[model samples]
Target: MSILLKASDLKTPMSASDLFSRTGPLVFEVGFGDGRYLEHLASANPEWNLVGAEVSLGSVWRAYRRMNRSGIREVRLFKGNARFLVRDVFEEGSLDRVFVNFPDPWPRKKHLKNRLLQVPFFQILSSRLKPGGSLFLTTDHPEYFEFSVQQGQESLCFDVIQGPPPPATLETKYARKWRDQQKPIFHAEFRCHTVIPSAPRPISSIEMQHATLKGSLENVGPFTKQVRRFEGGHAFVMEAYRELDSQGLLFKVISEEQDFRQELLIQAWPKKDGVYVSLQPFGDPMTTKGVREAVLAVTDWLVSQGLELDQTWV
Candidate 1:
């Protein structure tokens, strides 16, 4: 199998045992840039199964190439938010160690929310890690290091310890740059003291959603933007486009919830009887309430244009 894995390759709340061919210790690295460290880990511990998550497509490609060149087979890489993998996937207590090296500090006060090391994330990590599992983080930013330590403590799930980073960490690309610049490197180990309850907050319970309307698609033009607010989240229909080849319209929508956001497309195509409105599965969108609301927002917008709601499935 290819070392690189798409989001659809694994299910929500996936099992570590299912990821690897043989059972072994599970090591995860978040933001694995260039895949050097993960390569080192896999080489050094041949029995260990390594799983990495990276959001940057360039980084993922580079890592995949490096792994392929090294003939590494025990590593699986995911391209997406690490928070989603840790919180929604990776069965409870399946992780043995999580490495975070030189992650973006998001130094600006206004951008603090974008920083990955937050209290809620720590809590999620606590629940995912085994009894002795720990989060090892290394960074050159003093403010971010302190912020991470404080967040770990605030989660009340770990006993934080300041210490020297592993020797392998200094060999990474960013680590070498920081060392060359004579920047101070800080390392910490957030040892798990408590395992929070295993709760996977899935986006939605249903797999798919759709609606049928009793209206004509004729003159359903000049689509206006719409927004729908529901409990815990909101959906915004930013823009709509008409498909020239067929009598269909595509609406670009964004759905937002705490710590999760998705951009999706809702499609409205004419049927033999009426109009059909459903979420397009282009991005493998999770059917969250916000997403459902997005479909409703599009339907309501059509309703405003004189479409009657005949049947509902959302």
Candidate 2:
């Protein structure tokens, strides 16, 4: 199977060359639907390292299987929001090229802000590209196409160049479908002419610390559905699991801020002093306010379950 990168494996603002283990031109595909174009690019350019960000787990799995079968080792797949990966994970000016084929138009009037080709997105994307690097976009939706063009022009960071879609891009399922339906595909290249300052990402990391409590440990079992609200966001504990043969309990949690959300795991295990609680390392979650609230939520839940609080460094 092809190696897949989990969010936990990435450092904030990672080095693309180091991740690929080679220095070469780096390319990113925002929504590599069906993975056809991604595979084609990897095969066509052996000297280029490719990275893809996809939100759908099913799509990611299918793409991974295809890459493994094709023996394509120069590609990495990130399963999450492309914006998060681009804005938080990749270093500034680390990319040579970026591709977006048939992204969701969010056609409804109320949903326009959800479209990917907005002005803010253009500004952020431009900051990630090296000098002269370009963003290639192809979409079948006429309205989204025009919208993207207007946003690119307004951003002032890219010199928009109307162009034909790249050959590999045409291999994507959406591109072929649109072609068969006689829909004219709109293509535009946004060449970075000026450097745009990187925006600060609303993410932070915290040192995971253990807590001690003195109480009846036997009552500290699995918890049911519970929710907690914090200053910036809220957290919900969906379920809890007990580690066999150990006094460790793992809580599956969902934490959400206005613009970001993550599924995390928090653990409460027995220590010599008492019960230790902290965010689990397995999920590789970015430390955000919501995440901190999640840790606190779990700790507070334990206290509610009759566990006496001794000392906490969560």
Candidate 3:
């Protein structure tokens, strides 16, 4: 199995057997910055499956190289919001331990909403953790640590306990930076006391579909930026480009559903009978309702421009 995993590599309800060569326990690290702590976990527990999520592409590549150099095999890494894995992928009671090492505090009052470890997330995390499983958090920011504990308490699923920082956590890049300045690091463990029911999944897997519009580009009117809102999300058609060679049109679209956001392109090209409107697979986006609605919105715009809506599968 490859060390790097994409969003599509994950199943709706992920299984441990499919992820690791040998699974003694499943450990997940959120925003595994430079991956030093993740490497530590994998090296110390070769029998365990160490899964990590990182949003930065540079960090993902750096971590991938570090793991390769160490010849680590019982690990898998994902480059996206870790919440998606916890909320939509992992099966209930699948996680043994979770780690959050020096996560961004989002200290400003206005940006507090951007902070992770909120009450809803704590509840979701509680559902995924096995009985007695705990989420270990180590950070230099005292306020964030206290906020997380209070949020976990509000969830009513965990017993927050002050604890010593893990050895691996102290050696991370951020940890070393803080240590050089003699800043105090706080550690806590939120042990699961009661496993709540899994929260409803806001995003789901769907097959991307195309629409067959019975019209010609010559008959279509000028394109304009459009926005469409659906049940759980919204999409924006940001720009349109006309292909000079084939007279095709491509639209750049952005969609947001919950915490997940996707930017993709939809192409409208002439066919034998009509114009074929479909999503271009340039970004490897997970086909979700928002993305499907993006295509629908584009097709609807063409219809408003006088194109005949022959059929649509979105």
Q: Write the per-residue lDDT of candidate 1 for residues 54-86, one digit (tens) a residue.
A: 888899999999999999999999887888788
Per-candidate Cα lDDT values, in order, are: 0.87, 0.82, 0.87
- Quality of model 2 by C-alpha lDDT: 0.82
Q: Could you tell me which residue pairs clash in candidate 2?
A: none
Q: Estimated TM-score per prediction?
A: 0.88, 0.88, 0.92
TM-score of 1: 0.88
Cα RMSD to the true fold for all candidates: 2.5, 2.8, 2.1
TM-score of 3: 0.92
lDDT of 3 by residue, 197-299 (tens): 9754745677857999988877565667899999877899999888888989999999877666678899999999999999888877778887789889999
- Residue-level lDDT tens digits of model 2 in 1-314: 13578755666678876578879998999888778998999888999999998888899999999998899998999887788777777788898999999999999999998888888888888878888999999999889999899999999999899988877777798889988989888899999898788853636666665566776456665567889997767899889888898878888999976545689998888877678777876766776667778877887788989988888675
Which parts of model 1 have CA positions greater than 4 angstroms off? 288-290
Q: Candidate 3's error at 67, in angstroms?
A: 1.9
